[model samples]
Target: MNYFGLNHKRNNISRDSLLLEIYTMNLPLYDLTLIVPTFNRQSFALRNMRYWSGRDIVMHVMDGTKLGLTPLQLAQLDDNIHYHHMPELSIGERLNEAIDLIETPYVTFLSDDEFFIPSALSSCISQLKADDELVSCMGLSIQFEYKNGNVIGRRFYQSLENYSLLQTDALERMLAHMDPYVMSSMNSVVRSVVWKRSMRLLCIGDLSTFNIGELLFELAVCFQGKTKVISEIMWLRSYENKIIIDHAKTKSFFIWWRSDDKSEDRSKLLSCISSILTKTSNEREMVKSFMLLALNRYVNTYDKIIIGKDFFNDIIVKIWLLIPNNIKNILRLVLKPFIKFNTTNLILLVAKEWSHEGVKTNFIELCEIEKVIQYFYKVEK
Candidate 1:
């Protein structure tokens, strides 16, 4: 009923910004705040800021670089943005720092290079408003990158559709979220109260593996409430892992767990997890069992090989890419019933392969997809 970003009508909107208001549904301006953390990537920071400037949204950008953004750089953003320069902090520390400043009922993270469909976000906000037990809600996420000047992506989660964790017991909810171990649920729109606690442990724990902190976030939040994946397409993630590599270069999995270097942080992290788990199960052994569950799963999953790295069979995908679009569609139809491609088996894939009902036409003409693809096309790796 309301136009997004127009809740407080402007006196005189610029012609350019006026044209960029394409979001159809109204998103409650006060209900959610998107946290974006960036480090050393200037183009990424600017690219992200420019895109969101046009759309009316509340965002808190945490810059970890030693140098603060210049005046001209800050000029590009809008009043909706609250920029903070937090120097000399790890990504985890920056996030841990941002949690306390959140005043919104719902909180979610958007990376400097990622994009979100407005309607998908609105639908998720609606879901959270209706469900008391649901701690988080997001739509199916697809990871994409520019391949030969075209947008290419793949499903980010295995069988991600209609996924829900509504188990009354916190322990049950946490187990289901971890057993399959989807990439990262940290980006999903979550309640501030739950996400804050998760971030507290995540930052203090600072496993750097991303798996433990991420899975622990799942367990910690699910320890509080439920989570869901809606029908709408939510996030368009960048497939580039430069940011991942750069951040993890200093600490590999072994160093974080076995080496004496991370001893104090790791101890603090485990102790926090134990302290939190004790709230659910009073027995020391039970708390230890759950801590072991979180610890055992990620003693070393992606030290040398980042977990984001695909362990799947991609030869078929390579050959699939070599074929023409018509032939690819025909082959996909033929292969549809025979095999299912999951998060494990699929890596960076052609976006056209996963086209939905109305998507067969103008597949690249998706919501903000073209803009994002254009940004990726121009930016350096």
Candidate 2:
């Protein structure tokens, strides 16, 4: 392992000893504890578990529900997978619990609605073993949309796959401003020991936090360490109509109205960034500079205006007057019919509209789009 500079502490784990540990536990062991935390979405989780079973992957499915499984699904679960129920935990808490039961050296949290490709785990393991310094590794995640039991999708959701594998130091600098890689507990695999170190940082003063949970864990693991990113798609994430999404999109300014305070969330995020900034002089500037750029994009991409007495309606009305009157009227007319259609139909219509602007090139570009279709077709690993 490349234990340079700050990672010198890991030098105690010599190559021979580490190799012994690996060999004793079956060197380069493919064993992985797939920790999945699920709520009422038992059906989706079950299907996802079944998909992973083809790879002979060990699973630790944690049910964050009080009622346990709906009898039928419980009876249907494969014996190879272990299922446990714990309703008194948040997603992050459940993840911590699941990781505790993992006997393998590596673990990857897989969300119930998300799916993994066949070779995703194998690829991730190879990258990690090849680069002994990598604290963790992640691969590309192409987005897909499903409708009416039929799947349809689009690729390069935000062009994240455009970038290549990043060094831990470089990624930390970037994350100081805005996270380049999306923050999700389920997207990547990490060394069990690294995760255990992170769990300590995640829980502060015996009071566990939730919203910034995964972000904190990622920051801790990547702190002055190495990380790898496989360009190949590994995870398939689905964000249909989740409650977390609803919470994040809140526009209400009533500070007391929220169940959880966001002040902590903002503080934890800033702290993580500030820690990274202190690492290097050049990195400090890069992090702050990129953060500003991301903030601007965030404002532009997600704009909502609220007017008095319109608590329930969309805030898009406020921007309508800014456009030329003729174009505004034209949009209103065109959008009315589109709004009447179902979300899937509307997405297809919009996708067709944007298809002309797509930058189609060679196999790589085609591969990108095909990957999206693969996710929809359950081909993603």
Q: Write the per-residue lDDT of candidate 1 for residues 155-180, one digit (tens) a residue.
A: 76645666788899766665666555
Candidate whose lDDT is highest: 1
Q: Between which residue pairs do clashes occur in model 1?
A: none
Candidate 1: where is the Cα deviation over 4 Å?
1-23, 54-56, 209-211, 241-269, 276-289, 293-337, 340-365, 375-381
Q: What local lDDT does model 2 show for residue 317?
A: 60
Count of clashes, each model: 0, 3
Residues forming the 10-long window of minimal summed lDDT in candidate 2? 1-10
lDDT of 2 by residue, 192-212 (tens): 776665654454422232333
Task: Give the TM-score of each candidate.
Answer: 0.71, 0.56
Q: Tally clashing residue pairs in candidate 1.
A: 0
Whole-model lDDT for model 2 versus the true structure?
Answer: 0.52
Give stretches of model 2 more than 4 Å off.
1-29, 70-72, 156-159, 162-186, 199-210, 241-243, 246-381
